[model samples]
Target: MTVSTDPGEAATAAPPVNGNAPGRGHRGPVWLALTLALGLLLGIGVGLVIPQFLKPGDTSPEAGFLRDMSTHHAQAVEMSMIAHSASTTPEIISLSSDIALTQHAQIGYMQAWLRDWNLSPTSSQEPMAWMPDAEGSIVNGLMPGMATPEQMTALRAMTGKPLDVEFLTLMRQHHLGGIHMAQEILKLSDDKNVTWLAGTMVTAQQGEINLIDMLLKKLQTA
Candidate 1:
């Protein structure tokens, strides 16, 4: 809780759980940093070579979904990093690492596609405008299930079981929103690459949602 932005600042030590410190098996900071770096590099390498055989126009549903979902994934990465650095629960630490690495790499692919299409990653169009009847789903420019700034701030200030519970709860909602967008894209787009990635998000996030639910129940009962 009250996580420091400075890498040089030592984190507040979390108490041991079940006779082992949290992050016992988790990657150290150096390895985590390297793994994230490697993931992005690999993503960019693949994205650059992937044939942009079906280039979606600047305002196409494919572009909008990529742009908006990139933004959505960015927040998830931020939240996950916060939890990963501070949570006492081993399950949460590991889950946070997986989410952060996976989404950050996906962002590399999404941005590379936009670059290949000669499109701006940041759009002039309103978020989710490409989806039919998606009006008013955005609140204060935040899309569905995104944590409010206040909630993120609260999450930073929490510790111990509270941090673990809040992270799981928020992430469960985040995954649901992500799955909804991915599903809508699958219905709306026929571009092979876009559909493939969207399908992946739907499947992976749904599975993660199940794990999050199980973890939340265990935390609550404990």
Candidate 2:
């Protein structure tokens, strides 16, 4: 499914909610949340000891991917939080919550790995520089599939079906970009742990993209 890169229509004026939808609640699976929490704790614990065996340098692709993807994941969490709070649709609420919690945990793993390598979370090199011939990919310092400030502000002001549609649309684009980076890492990194995480991202985000497409079609047609 193709979406406008800018999502101009999604950024239009819409009725706003006070904070969260009054009667709406997230119906996402409880077990999933617990599993993610457990995984995060385990990841951090393992990260502390892993560096004694092998650690990537500051300019290594593993380091760059971890740092850049952490930043990328942060925006996804932010957008999901906005959608989770305001959207009244059960599917949107559940999906947004899942995305937020999942990516937030993944961020923990990425940052932990960075610390294990004794590398700074922020990088001096350009984003995506680790990827070969990746010039022009970063537009105005924003990574691929990231929303602009104006688009995010417009999303904050929207409510109801409009908000749901926009959130799903934006997230779908975001996932595609994320999946690309993850796939690239899978190809570039020989590190077993890093490639494993990248593989998981590619698989999970692709599945979510399929769901997002279904949700978008349902929302748009309704």
Best by lDDT: 1
User: Lowest-scoring 10 consecutive residues by lDDT in candidate 2?
Assistant: 12-21
Task: Report the C-alpha displacement of residue 220, candidate 1, in angstroms.
Answer: 0.6
Query: Which regions of candidate 2 fall more than 4 Å away from where they truly are?
Result: 1-53
- In order, what is each prediction's RMSD in angstroms? 28.0, 30.5
lDDT of 2 at 54: 69
The CA lDDT at 91 in model 2 is 97
Q: Which pairs clash in model 1?
A: none
Candidate 1 C-alpha error for residue 3, in Å: 97
Candidate 2 — what's its lDDT?
Answer: 0.88
lDDT per residue as tens, model 2, 113-196: 888777899988999989887786787778878888898999999999999999998999899889988988888989998998
* Candidate 1 lDDT score relative to the true structure: 0.91
Off by over 4 Å in 1: 1-54
